[model samples]
Target: AEEARQTTQFEPLPKSLFQPLPPFEDLPRPLSPSGASALIDEAKQAVIDTGSPVLDTEAEPGFAVMRGLALHKLLQMLPGIAEAERRDAAARYLKRAGAQWPETERDKALASVATILADSHFDQLFASNSRAEVAVMGRLEVKGKLRSISGKIDRLAVTSGKVSIVDYKTNRPAPATLADVPPAYVLQLALYRALLQPLYPEHEVSAALLFTEAPRLIELPPAVMDNALARLTGA
Candidate 1:
């Protein structure tokens, strides 16, 4: 009856039950902006130490990282302050950060913030009912493959019964279309959507990328996301 049906629904797959689980090491956890940058540098150094064929590490802590961090701080303060106050705060932070930036790069970093603030898309997204630096975690089962997924969403917008996941990027020349988005970014958004959809079954879930450099939002299409999931789990 109801009990037997429930048991069948929750039964583990035979292959999964027999398969060896992954090692109990520290999972690949998301890090803060600065921490992520440092980790990249460390990883590059490790590759260099091993004398592996790795790309040059000449762009560590590049302008994109600096601009993204400054913009993140501005967005965090925007919700709590008036338009004028928000502008003042952004200016102050950029000035402080630029003081430490190299003379050749200081002006470019500060200018990027002004450009972002001026973008209509940037203003609209932040003005929405959103939470910053939100953490998401869930177990995803795709095509019989089960895996644990966790990451910190840059922004989560909840309006009425619709949910939007927003991730910030600092690509110099922002992607012009959904197809232009990096594969890793597309997969990340797909994973976020999967993790969130079940929790808000009644709400429609969607995701987009906000490229800080170009200051625009690119909505991810459902079909593209499905493909990403298929590739992710080799379904």
Candidate 2:
């Protein structure tokens, strides 16, 4: 419990892609009891059925969790990258990935997720005005009820005043440029953006895909955000 509390207090911060990014040295960790490092290591790296280590620097637990956070952030900011076209692209990429890059997919995903955790720009873009609140948010009306939106928005500042929806992507680059993005990711972000606009009612929204697998952050056009949100009106 103490460890968990410490984890909450020292939230993960992202590193910048430009220039030489700073290493995250300030994030705090609870110091374990004397001589407990061995036990902690055992707990962190327990083997799993999927043939993957639980907590690995090579495939760090922080990596996957950050990927999820990146997705949540993108959903709040730029979700267009994950809309129908992108989702379709993601699917096709995944298939091609399985055929041509199957052996490295897992490693690639780990790299993607890791970049998300260390994304300095990501942390800055999503940082809230309220210092007390680690989990910042906004809302939009979906149908009737006030819907909660804005979860870990990595590039909220980057929209340059456009409403952007974004999804976290772990897929690697492809010869087909669009296929580099995973489509289901876009769909997921689109739903979140559609939910937000009506609830917030003030902000002009847009969408994107923050590729954790690579350093690229891809934006989706406003038209895609509008069309996707329109489709959700009946639902």
lDDT of 1 by residue, 66-90 (tens): 6567666666655657666666676
Estimated TM-score for each candidate: 0.68, 0.36
Per-candidate local distance difference test: 0.65, 0.43
Q: Which candidate is the best by lDDT?
A: 1
Query: Which residues of candidate 2, in runs, are more than 4 Å off?
Result: 1-126, 129-165, 173-180, 230-235
Q: Report the C-alpha lDDT of model 2 over 1-235, residue by residue, as the tens digit.
A: 9999999999676555455867976632321111111221223462122211112334456554453443343334332343335444444444443344344553454344345545676554344421211223445444454444444433444243445444444432321344444333444456556555664576776666665545566766556645444433324
Give the poorly placed runs of model 1, Cα more than 4 Å off: 1-63, 102-124, 142-145
Report clashes for each candidate as comma-separated counts: 0, 43
lDDT of 2 at 106: 36
